[model samples]
Target: MPAFVGAIKINDISGSAVVNIGDVFHIEPRSQTKTFAGAGSFNTGNYLRVKNGYSVTHTVDADNVDNSNIGNT
Candidate 1:
């Protein structure tokens, strides 16, 4: 998981959810610090470093429908 600067809500109803860099998801920011480091990278006191590329995606909907609020209802 990427280093999120703030709190994030990840709703995985199917019990199988994967998140990857470059992949977009609906996020409700609960704090002012919402910045995030790049994939396989991190920031340290104004210094940024990269390691390895780790990315993946989850199946929110098998039918590919816009189910952004799947578990809210």
Candidate 2:
């Protein structure tokens, strides 16, 4: 299964509920972190962590992530 970052969620074409990250489980593929500190360009981070059992933190590299705008494409 693919991982998610931030509050970005993935829904099937049927629009069914998938899963939500609650900072609990510390799921995988959390490197796709996109934070909006300001308004002007998107701030992309290469590292992301999910707290496992609210204790250990798991981190992974984004591996050349792209955050360019696509405007409706």
Top of the candidates by lDDT: 1
Worst 10 residues of 2 by lDDT: 30-39
Prediction-by-prediction clash tally = 0, 0
Task: State each model's CA lDDT, in order.
Answer: 0.46, 0.44
lDDT of 1 by residue, 1-73 (tens): 4555566576663433345544365654222222344554454565655566666544244564432544432
Best candidate per TM-score, number?
1
For residue 28, model 1's alpha carbon misses the true position, in angstroms, by: 8.6
Candidate 2 clashing pairs?
A: none
Q: Model 2 off-target regions past 4 Å?
A: 1-54, 66-68
